[model samples]
Target: MKKGSLLFVFILLLSSIAASIGFAQEIGKDKLFVAALGDSITFGYNLQEDKTKPSSQAFPYLINEGNAEVANISFPGWTSSQLLGALSNQETLLALQQADVITLNIGSNDYLQAIGLQELIENQTPIEFTPELQQKIAAASAQLSQNLQNILQTIRQNNQTAPVVFYNMYNPFGASEDPFLLSLHQAGEQITLTVNQQVLNPIAAASGSLLVDTYSAFSGNQAAFIIPGDIHPNAAGHQVLGALADQALASLVPAAPTVEIVFSTTEKTEGPVKVTVTADQDVLEMKWLPGEQTADKFSAAGNVINGNTFDVPENGTYTVYVKTQEQLEAVKTFKIENIVSKEEEEPPAEEEPPVEEPPAEEPPAQEEPPKEEEPAEEQPVTEQPQEETPVNETEKEERTSVKEESTTPVVTVKKNELPDTATAAYNYTAAGAVMIMIGAGTMLFRRRRARVN
Candidate 1:
């Protein structure tokens, strides 16, 4: 062959190989493998392990539902420093190789610890204000910001082609007045915002990467998103994250296709209890049997179901059968275990009757004169004056002689039947008796007075 003909053949071969490579790249782009790296919040910490399905509201699960395969490498309490350390490990490198999309959330812990350091310095200082401590805080904040930048740089080095999305730190403490904790939280917020805008955004913009703004979504709403006394997001918070993931993934993937089995729980006894069924897509009609059930029991509060609260009324083996759009069927079984009810325990019955020592013997009784004693003395005095001259001694003698002379009952004079003259005589005798008493009293009083003198 001529030299020009040989060169033309070589050029044609090179063109064909280039076309094939381009087609391969296109095909690879159709599918995605996502990996999440960071702390407990990225792991969906409070979410149940069994319930952490691809349908979960966590961002990874949401991305998977959008047709990407996802893996979560987040551990509780991991900081940017730790995450960078992990990237140097073989396992993390392998994971990075497999990941087409990477979501990173870190640096919050570092910011938190820096705040702790600030507090420690403040406590150690006796002065209310210290310029040295302030300088230290500023230095620490700058270091933290730089550490986050380094983390993003490391990720870029590992996966140059992958679209990296850096999630900004959220304000975990909302509207709190606790100065130390609040200052820490505010510092984290400000530092993260700066890092995202000045560092992460520019890098992403230059490299054609994606940036997911989680900070704005959960900023002031920290109280609503985080579990009380915990650093992790609650169910509703997961839902918010899932929604954001849905939006982010939509830009990268085609609309997702979903098949769900919805059922209402009525008088559930031992499930697999029968449940009413419905479907979003006409793939399968759901049914319940005595022993067979699978696919999660959709809850009223879950992303899918609206009216039913899925519950296992009693412990038993249950299975759910799902029929595909092609009329093919699949079934899965779940064991329902007994859940202990929360109830107050009854206190033990009163052991023995409280021992009662006979009420301490009352002090010996002291006798008290009758309340009517003075009244009784006054009554006798009044009666003596009125009866001063009741019948003379001669009348008394005559009555006794009459009683002796006759066998009949003796006739006694009645004091009440005395005549008017007898009454006048009684009064005169009373006056004489009173005069005598006065004379005796005066004589006694004069003798006492003489002694006193």
Candidate 2:
């Protein structure tokens, strides 16, 4: 019984030592604890379907390629004031306290609000940014500066040791070729530069935070970095930004190894296109989506196909998403302007039957001589007209005399009083004659009797 107790106590001592060693190693680990906070740029808008969650292609995910612990607390359409208000939350304060590196990019929405940004993006109309509005934005910028300073102070109070990397704004619409957008582009660029130069630079310097010059990095290259119709950075742009942030934190934590992804397409620009992705790391899987979009976890949100080659029946933008064995993802976009449809390619075969068979079959019908017998079949019609001709001729003669009979005036006199009066007179004369004859016959009879006596 004594030996059994000693053995148990010896086992407990080793277990306690192992626990202590594990805790020490965990505390001494060099992996970074990154906290991402800001607006839609850090939240990765348009990169995925769900706006409430950060995308896998966001800068936080790209920074260590999911190697370090990251907490993305950014939201879309958040202004500097809102971020300042959020710093008082217990959960936000806790995350900041545990962070070894914190990335911040706010104040874009504060300036965009003056130019009707939401209406402009939805309606696609140019922002006026009139002189009065410019003055208003300038006044608002002063307030924004104060808000940013307060936000930094709160973050510093929560996390005194972590390096805060603040990114300035970039003019995503500056490269637009539209004439109406030109004014907006200019005004936006000027405000962005002013904010970066006067506001962010001084605050970052005073707060002992690192200022990442995103404006200079994205100067005329917005077409490559920004999403086509949106103001957020694309997958490639996020990767570049992540690299910049990683460079800023290099002194404290080692930068992650770079994964090289090379994507190319077939020589033909339009039909039956082929895309090939070659990387230094082993490729795990890839997905294809139409238009421009980044990859998410397991290539979710079906936009493109699931293969490397495509023979689609459309002509537009297509994006290819590739994932490596190390769980790193990359995206590439290609523009296909023309697509030759199968119907168009088979038109010659379809036309051959009509072109050849119609002529060959129609000649026999034309040479049949059946049309000559058609007139013979019409002979009964002529016979039928001949039978009715004598009746028609009698009718025509009667019709011809009707006008002459009507114009003669004999019928008119008979219709008037002359015929009636003539008839009456003839009747009277006949009656008188008859009466005289009767009287003469009676006298002759009497004279003959006297002569006889």
User: What RMSD does each model have against the real structure?
Assistant: 24.7, 27.4
Give the per-residue Cα lDDT of candidate 2 at 227.
Answer: 90
Residue 298 in candidate 2, Cα distance off native in Å: 45
C-alpha-based local distance difference test score of model 2: 0.67
Q: For residues 1-453, write the lDDT of model 2, one tens digit per residue.
A: 356434543543343333233323333455668888898898898888887788888888776444657788778999988888888889989998887677888988888886677777668676665788778788778888778767766665676566777788888765557765675577668778887888778766555566788988888888899898777899889988988886665544322223333334434444555445444556676666788876663345653434444454467787667666645567777777555555544444444444444444444423232222222232221111111112365654554444433332331322333322223334444456566667778789999999999
Report lDDT per candidate.
Answer: 0.56, 0.67
Question: 281-383, model 1: which lDDT tens digit per residue?
Answer: 4543444443653434421111222232244456666554545463444444555554344467899887987888887888886655334322222222333
Q: Which stretches of model 1 miss by more than 4 angstroms?
A: 1-31, 48-58, 64-68, 117-158, 176-207, 252-453
In every candidate, how many clashes are there?
A: 5, 4
Which of the numbered candidates is closest to the native, going by highest TM-score? 2
After TM-score superposition, what is the CA distance of residue 267 in candidate 1 from its true location, in Å?
Answer: 65
lDDT of 1 at 247: 64
Candidate 2: regions farther than 4 A off: 1-30, 120-129, 251-453
Give every collision pair in model 2: 288-304, 288-305, 289-303, 289-304
Worst 10 contiguous positions by lDDT, candidate 2: 380-389
